[model samples]
Target: ADDDECNNVTNICGEWANCSNTNGSYYCTCEPGFASTGQPRFQTNDGTRCADIDECAVVRQLCGPFSDCHNTNGAFYCTCQRDYSPSAGPRRFQPGSGTHCRGNHRDMANLTESRSMLAEIAAKTSGGELTSMEVISYVEALSLSSSWHFEGRGDMEATPSVINTTLTNLVEAVNNLVEKEELVAWTRMAEDLRENTVTKLLHSVEQGALALGRASSTPLQLDIRASEMELKLMTFDLAQDQLSVSMGGDHIQITPKASNGSVCVVFVRYDSLGDILKPSSDPGSADYSRFGGTGEITVNSQVPIDVDADVTNCAFWEYDLGTLQGHWATHGCERVLVNSSATTCSCDHLTHFAILMSSGRSNLVAHSNILTRITHEIQSTRTTIHKNLCCSLFMAEFIFLLFCSVIAGLLHYFFLAAFAWMCIEGIHLYLIVVGVIYNKGFLHRNFYIFGYGSPAVVVAISATLGSKYYGTDKVCWLSTENNFIWSFIGPACLIILVNLLAFGVIIYKVFRHTAVKKPEISHYENIRSCARGAMALLFVLGATWTFAVLHILHETTLTAYLFTIANTFQGMFIFIFLCVLSRKVQEEYYRLFKNVPCCFECLR
Candidate 1:
């Protein structure tokens, strides 16, 4: 009965076991990753606890260069080596560090590759072996001189020191290539000296690296050096872009060259015409006809033309370029010549002494050879043009006149005032006809102001204002061509508006006064002609303004003359209409013109 009863527990290990009364017992032990302590602490579960082990301390000197392995509680850290400072940029690492360690072999492989790549680049650039004593010296100097420093460092690194080291190394290579006699030989074979300088310099640099070994290897740093070379070449190329010439009253010949050494010759002929175009028996040929000459002539490299033999039309133009009478024929050199052709010559003209040059160089360069000469010619020509135009004196006078005219009176304002005077005249006429002036004393004063003093004030103001707007010109009057404001728009509109209103008012007064009861024949007879004359004057004023507006919109030179004619003769025309033609006014005008003094005592 006791044997039939069973237990559920079982002994599972030597120290720690599981027991089962009815089943078999088993032994238990700790795994290889764990270690056991002999002493057991009194706890609730009573399980065995083992501390983490440091394997690195146990296995020393196993990790390779560029890597460090560390052990912590239950963990370890393997860090990759850092070449540059953290602040310099991101670090180049073979494998990640911290927590997940890369194999030691992999880290070593990455470091070797990095070093090899750097060596290859430096070798290709300097045309020297990376391991050579000279190259190593310069590389060490560059590292010390670099403008970059380690993080948290105080002293600033020197960039120029590194550049100098690199430059010295490159210069040494250049000298080596030159000493080999390759540079001199290549330059001798090259056509252009400039090209030889550039090509030989470039090829020497490439050859320099080859001398240092790794002739077939390409380095990444070669791109940087090539870029620097390109920048230097471009700067030199732009420095010689333009071709300049100077024709100092002589004939010149020159050959121009491209960057590639292709030759082109340019001939230029400069002339001066002064006494030849003077007015004489040839009135029609004075101004425009004698001023005939091409402003400039340019041609490539060509043989020089004989000034004495090839020159034709009149001795003055015989040596000129592109003339109507004189022509050119090519003789020897491949030249672009500007020969004196009769087609562009002038008779009785003063011509500049021709300059003829024969050389395989540019006309502009050989002519403007000296910088001091360039300065002198520019200054002299500027002074001559100003003096010849008479502008030196004309400008001073113009400025003086402008100030005086403006202070005296503005012309356009006077024009408006003149229009106001015309209106006043119309009003005076109306008042006279209406018999509002019972006394004769007012007539003299009113007529003087309306006819003379008002016009004078208006004229003064208009003239002053006009002078300000016009500044200076060939003629004194305002015209569309000169861009004058007062003479064109101001006077034109003012005249039109004033005349229209005056005409309308007079017409309306005549109609109103005669509407209700017919005035006596005497009244009618006295005002009729005056009214007609007033109307005619207004019509003429309007027509004058209309023409001014038309000229402003469409500047016809002939119309400009018509306006001048109208302005110049207006005083006489007005006198005819307003004075001599008017029967009432004509008697008074004739008496005034006779210069006869009236005597009241004589009548007595």
Candidate 2:
């Protein structure tokens, strides 16, 4: 009764199929994957030939949608179609297996590309070989330097981990921007940041071999903030970013290359997984411009074209590469220049610059250190002007003019003080001969008032009547613009003449007494004493400014040079005569050095 019946079921089915044995009769049965063709359902009778069933054909709604189903000997597989890829579930599975597909591979590709590009840019910032893409991104092609020529690409490079991290963050930021549709502002972000890409394959033992594009999964903010070492302050608030700076009076110029140059971009690859873009929450009001405005800028022969003011205006803007006006307006605040390429901001007031493009070679930005210094000066000026009642009286409008007035007033007082002191000296001598002293009395008080008050009245009257005479046309102080400086010169000459005459008469009397013993003055007279006394009298009587008189009257070169030379060194001469040349001062210096040597000897 045992009929050679496929015993124990060894080798009864093919390698791709399953097997089972019947009763004592020993019949064959196809397993789950293999079946009999043209039979009822998926079952097969004994002795019927077993064949592979096409699950893809029998089931119409298999593997969900946008996927391909393929039949194998004993199993079937599912795969995503073009523009779609499997994101969830097993790739090789049953026909009705639940798997998902993603559609934003381009966004991921864009991210990967931009990240690589950024890394390349950061590397070049320290000075090295740069690609055309970097030149475009830096907008450095518009710079004044001729060295920014194009270097061909084709090297799929890896950058420092920190730079890679920066690129990764930037990619995520742009991806977020894309989701919010704010990217529509910039040439549809110039084709959603498209660029060149190269793939990298990796041999993974556990997961078999793999391939991918260079990119980061780490998300980032659209507002780009490079590391402090990389560049100046930069930010993009979806629509605009603000940079506050003050360049001291160094001439500013925004020099753009203006010439056309080649361009390049970055890319990454993931062979099996491909690339993907994931959407997040919409950008909140805090991350973007509040008032509706134009993100586009226009430039032709002039600076930035005037945009509608009703549109939201921020403090700064994103600028294209070019020469810009940076117009510091006295009227409106519409002068927030985003990309500044100006080389000539003024030395006065809060200048609002206009962001404009430039061509050819020139410095494109101002230094913040210089700007900060200027701001400090401006603040100091404000503080000083605040203390003056005259400034406040005029509502602080004529500060420069006031500064000129102050200098003029000082010059007027110099001569007045000298004349007053000299007159006092003469009166003191007369009183000494009469055997009288007025050190403390109504007379002394009156002398004090005349010495100080007279000069004040003179300067005040001059300033009121001939205010224009105070300063030069080009500068703030007295100049050759008019004979206005004569207000200072005229009094100086008169005082010199008066002092000379009075001192000369006094010196003549002393010399005559020294030449011959005078009545009851034999003990007070000597030729040596007379000469020394006369010199001292001339010095104390303010005769040093005598040469200056010759200078003011005659406009000859010798006189001019002499006048300048004297005045220029007048302070030094005073120091020499009073402190350096004095016998007491000489003794003091010797005493200092002698002590130093004595101390050293003691230490030894």
Candidate 3:
């Protein structure tokens, strides 16, 4: 009972195994850096098969910090990183040998000697001396490099490997008077050596012998070429909108005529930055001999530069992104705004990008907050280019532009659907107001055919004539200037005019037949208020629509503004007549909202 467990098995078990005693038996287990190879075992040290383990595979990165680990079949080894040296002895070590790397590469001899002496003193002090293992762990923690790189600071951080963060824990650990003075002396020596190394590197960089960014003394000049060679951004005096770009130019811009519309900018590089950054065979030289760029880019680009809006689609459009969902999966790169944060997407990754323009009166609101949302969409679809990804840049741009045209054609069909309903409402209003009696089945079927079929015929005929009809200037619609605007304007005006005439005829009929009661005034009172309130209802329905017609015909600044106002109020008048003034609607509104106040109070 008094004999120790380890003492009893010390002879049978090899140094690599630890033995544990159970009630009537004892088992030997291999230690941390050792394992059994499934061999038949005997109770003697020679028969027990405890073998060295490859710590690199077991721990993933089992070497000392700031070092590289290499694995062998049954053993592992570590080598210090660049500008670092081993703390124990030289710059390499075997596994289970403990921490072997520390900072201060330029003065390795002096710093290593000082660290060793301090560790020895800590191991053999006044109290119970610390073990060699404990001293190594303590010294390793104090000697490890702790300086962090600040990325946003860019080239300013300078990344000098000679300097290392101090071991503040050592200042507190040493209580002996002699050891404390030695700690201060070693700290000063390390600082002076680091400063001297940094000064030398700096001097070499200034003399053009060392390249800090792999950049040359002269700024790199890039020859810029563009697809639309003659295009230029319009000056403010020309129209207040434009786009263009030039390399080495004082000002950069990119745009075409509003009617022509849209352009793409591409970035190109001959070789990757990583390749140029590699060290040359000559120690003092770098491989970045031919790479050139002053590294300046100006956005100065605009969408729908001189383009105008039309009736069919919005001057601003939201993409139907579902159509493109799986088409881009094979590119190994996702669509993102060109920027450096996309580390996984190298500079050369290609993507299809489109700048779809809105047709809904963009000019008036384009420069204001109303179009700020459209600007954001353009930004989200903007392409990101990396230095390595210069290939296929123009091809992707062309593909994206073609995709927009196809999407616009599909969208034009949906726009025609709205006309389908507008025509139906007009025909129904005309028949009822004119007092034309017909079978419900006959009238409904004919109007439905005319409503849905007429718009489709117009769209197909216009597109067959030319798909460009929908790609007027900025939006996907009938061109305002190409007489194709008539596709929407003709049907819209016909519906509005027929309804207007119907309202007029109804008013005329009401005045001719109705008689006023002579309660307030004589016969003149009846003559004075012709049709009484009938005229008011007729004007409410038809007058708002007349404003649009007048604006198109006159095409004045005042009429342009008047049409914008009329368009906004048109929906309001429809809502008032169809819902607000209707008896059934009034009842439902009150019923739905009657308990709203009570419900709100309960929630509160």
Candidate 4:
């Protein structure tokens, strides 16, 4: 049995396909289906066994010609799907190819349109039921302003699906909201636009404000509020107080009212130096305040050497601003007083009045501190010009040498020289009163020249240079008399720099003197006090120049007009500061004029 179980030998010729090995002989009965290669059909000692065979030739026609057919040794199969279709071509589905045919352009366009529509709908509805994409689109278009320029890149004639969808969504939302609340959805839309902080939004807001004002029951209050807002937002103050708003039961009317007060207030303030200071009093009369003069003077160029010393009203004065000297006097103002006498004069107690006569009682303060400082500037400029002339021939060789020199002087007086002198005067008073610096040496020689001459020389140089090269407008003289220079910028800057320097020096000196701990030891106890006074003067100069430069540089006026305006009230700042800010100056002011100062306590 062991030998039979163990393979000894087998024959394939066994009678059966199944065969078993024995020690000597082997017999094989019929096998199940196939016989092994090593076994004999009837031999007992034969080798192998038979295994079942799978033949699919019976299902030969399972797949049609659309598929390929494959047959194994005992099995066969066929694939007949569209993927394997013969007419589908080489690139359709291959061993290693990816190319495939797609639908036409119409299909793509329809797809894009649907996408756009969905996007638009989402935007318009902001997603009540619309797609999430539509909500995003609406949110993006909400904040629009004119600052952004739009590009028209898509089809011109066709309405974008996105836009259409958005509009539809918006309409639906409005209808729903309106039916629910009876509120105008359009107004809400406008408000939304306004909230976006866009330029167009803001502009719309402003227009809405105006419209609201027009529709309001009380417009005067609205006007006042609007005016106040404007003034607060912008640096320049408008002449609006003169305007009156009246409600006559039915309609509201707004109009300008002329100034009609008989009693005029002449306020006087001074620095410690007994110099008058200027301050903003009234916008209507901003051109003339304190020591400043307003109005125009014209020289008759056509007149052959006039034998008569008479100043008459100009037949044709220009206000067009384009022509030379066109901006001075249009038809000769009645308020203007053309005076031949060179004495200090105030016309009708108005700064706007032309000087026809010289009366020391100009109903105006000299703005003494400012004047003194300007005087000093003139002196400094003169020294500088002198130095420049000595050092280099540029001042002489330049065609505008004279013009520059004149402007330099003008700028000095107008800007710094005058203010510095005023501060010095303030210092003098502080020394005498507070610190008791009674050394007679304190009042130095050449004080007046330092205060006045320096500025004049500097202005003279500036004017000379500007006139020769830039233009033709005279300083301190009539425009027609000498077409020298109307260049206000150079002169104004030089003046500002000089005054700023002076102001800094005075402030530093004051702080320095006050820092000393031994106040009682020194005989010049007034040093600190003098410094304070100098600071007061500095304040006046600083204030005036700060505002004045702006007014001068503003290009709203022509050359002649600019020059005249700049010169007219240039000294008013110091005048107001000196007379209004200081007690001593106030006393001096009353003493000199024998009149009550305007709003004295308020000035202090």
Tens-place lDDT per residue, model 4, 16-95, is 35555666655565554343455334443434444443333445433343344455443344433422223334522332
- Predicted model with the maximum TM-score: 3
TM-score of each: 0.27, 0.28, 0.32, 0.22
- Residue by residue across 1-604, what tens digits does model 1's lDDT show? 3331124232232232222233232223333433344332211134544545565576664343434557766555555443212222223322233222222211212322222323433454354222222322333222322222222333423233432333344544333322222323323321333232322333333223222222112211121122112100000111234532322222222223443321111111211111122122221111110111122223222222322232221222122222222312223213223442212221222221112322111121111111111112213321232222122123323433454333223333334443434444445545555667445456545644553465466455545655443422322323222344444356447646765665666666666666545655466664784577555555334345556666545655577677656644444455455334645454554554555446333322
The all-Cα superposition gives candidate 1 an RMSD in Å to the true structure of: 35.0
Worst 10 residues of 2 by lDDT: 198-207
Residue 50 in candidate 2, Cα distance off native in Å:
99
Tens-digit lDDT string for candidate 3 (78-126): 9987545677865668647766666542222343333343344344432
True-vs-predicted CA distance for residue 432, candidate 2, Å? 4.1
What order do candidates take by TM-score, descending? Answer: 3, 2, 1, 4
Per-model clash counts, in order, read 62, 37, 20, 119
Model 2 Cα lDDT, one tens digit per residue, 1-604: 5544355545654343344444554434566777765443222244446688888898875776666888888778887765456776655555445566644222212323433443443343334232323322332211211111111223433333543454344333222222222222222222223211100001110001001111212221122222210111111222123212211211122222333321111111111111111111111111011011112221111122212112222222122223221211223223333221222212122121222211212122211111001112212221222212122212222333345445645645644655565555555554443457555456656666765576678778778878766644334444433355666667667766777777767766666645565555554446656666565555444566677777445434587567556544543443344345556556555655665866645433
Q: Indicate whether candidate 2 or candidate 4 has the larger TM-score.
A: 2
* Best candidate according to lDDT: 3
Ranking by lDDT: 3, 2, 1, 4
